[model samples]
Target: MVQEGLERLMDRIVLAYSGGLDTSVAIPWLAEKYGAEIVTVTMDLGQGKELDDARERALALGAVRAHVLDLRNEFARDFVLPALQAGAVYEQRYPLATALGRPLIARHLVEIARLENASVVAHGCGTEKGNDAIRIDLAVRALNPDLEVLEPLGVWDVTKQEKVAFAKKRGIPVPAGADSPYTTDVNLWGRSIEYGVLDDPWLEPPDDVYVLTRAPKDAPDLPAYVEIEFERGVPVAINGVTLSLVELISSLETIAGVHGVGRIDLLENRLGDTKSREIYEAPAGVLLHAAHNELQKYVTPRDLARLASEVGVRYADLVYNGDWYSHTREAMDALVAKVQERVTGAIRLKLFKGDHRVVGRTSPFGLYDQDRIAQSADTRPSLELRP
Candidate 1:
């Protein structure tokens, strides 16, 4: 059924597809609602083999064309690394993995829309009840306000099961794991799980919700230690071996996941002025932020360090709220960049069952001077004479 005013208004639409159920259903739905030709874009941001047949799936769902982009390297170097340097952690728990990916994805949506001569851009974000839909909307408008944006689920008012039925009725194949009540978003930086049983804030997340980490009880009995080296606040090496930014993060995720080191369950404040229970697994992000902060503190002065901490919170908020392209965010990035100039060093961490702490840090710019220390044993003589 075509919506009254929207029918025929959109001649062509470019959709940001995730190869998930929501997006699979969207290809046919968008075509029906607006009588438009639909082109789907699926981005690869280190989800491994999960995206193997995304293009084929999109084409089978009646898409005029399908685009599968490999954006992992760009995602890491351009999006993830800057947030790592800025120390952008939402509410000190979330590393904003999904948040950081939204802008980059939206940017490409606009580019694809222009190439396709699309009058509108669409997304499978589903609803405005959560953060992502708004993030997509704002980012697209920011990049190109002239392009109309559409969200099918915002108006569809259907349950997940209903969506499954809708897809089946149209001969669109339901994605694996569609029957599961939980909703998940995955990227290089983290994996976020929510909805269904997770909406109950009091209920502990089931073990099935986690894929990147082991249960704390099941982790190795012996503690594992890792040495991370940072150059200008970006992690460049692991245990004395240099790696690309993407490789470094992937290596840390494996090492830290084995120790069950990065699992966060929090009651998060959504941008819609509502609170919701969210679970996130970001092993690499956790380790890197801790290690980077340790080395940063070793070299940074008190006032500058404090300022970075304050700016970091705001930076996190802006990114989470979908203001990634704002001039204010750019200004904050400049401040963070200056802070990073002195943040080069190495951090050694102890990773024990679901816990990680920085046990050692060293930097060429470190301010501490051991020989000039005024210890209890040696400092009394000079002070007593003055008194």
Candidate 2:
């Protein structure tokens, strides 16, 4: 029986399927209940080889047309870059890993629905109380109000054990469980780890929970120095090596993770009721965010820097709430873009023992002189001002 509050029927539905446990179950559930052709769309945001089997999995599970899009570059440029410039971090700890992907995925789902001439789009998001269901629904509605959004799990009262049972009953193959015992979401930008034993805030996250970053204690003895160059707020080059955005971030994640630079185990306040303890491995984000923030200070005026900081907090909130398409977010992005015009600079940082220390920074619009700052100490340099 189809759950209440989701009664619109259609000839076909485009599902934002990830080939995960939830989505695998959704394919059959949608077919059984809606009696509509299921078209699965998987946006591949650099989840590695795990995505190779998505098309096969979707077809085997009951999808008629399975679309797998390589959206890695789009994810980086469209979503991650703005957040990077705005210094958007939820709760001052999370860099909005899963939150960032929702809008982009919703956009694709809507486009697929249009091409397929399907009035309904479906997703395997968590129940009604889950945060992602809100994000997906809001995004789909905002993009195309003509289309109807369906969330099967949002009304289906099924526990995890029951869901597992349902998958088994449907003959859906389950991925082998890891010993880490945590739910994980990964993309080109970052990784999110939560649930299970991580719910206890007092208990530190175990080493096995982190795959992108090494333990701080396990980091190499020697300090690794890296130079990151930004052009109008977007990362462009690393150590004078000019690479595409995707390549630069991927290289940085590897380099910084090996030095134990990006690991955050913090209590996150979710969009829905209740707080969550989530562990994140965002090696590149950790390195780049620091460089970008420091570069802003070097280029922008003191007053503007303070205002930008405030705007950054608001930007984080807007993204956290999945209000990316809202007018307020557009205004926020305008301000962030204005600030970023002057945020071009190169920041040198030392990565060691799970921490990044800014070593030096240089910008064409620098507001201060290093030599003058060193000479005056606490006193303001009486140097002549030049435009």
Q: Name the candidate that leads on lDDT.
A: 1
- In candidate 1, the residue pairs with backbone N, CA or C atoms under 3 Å apart (3 or more residues apart, or in different chains) clash, namely none
**Model 1 / residue 281 / CA error / Å:** 0.6
* Candidate achieving the largest TM-score: 1
C-alpha RMSD for every candidate:
2.8, 4.6
Candidate 1 regions exceeding 4 Å error are 1-5, 374-387
lDDT of each residue in 1-387, candidate 2, tens digit only: 134656555689899888777788888888888788999999988765478888998999999999999999999999999998999988777788788999999999989998999988888776533787788888988999888888888766687678788888978887566223577788988898877778888887777888999888999999999999999998999999999999999999999999998899887788767787878988988888899999999999889999999988999888888888899988888999999998888999998888899999999989988888777786765678889
Local accuracy by lDDT, each model: 0.88, 0.86
Cα-based lDDT at residue 296, candidate 2: 95
Residue range 277-307, candidate 1, lDDT tens digits? 8999999999998988778888988999989
Instruction: Report RMSD for candidate 1.
Output: 2.8
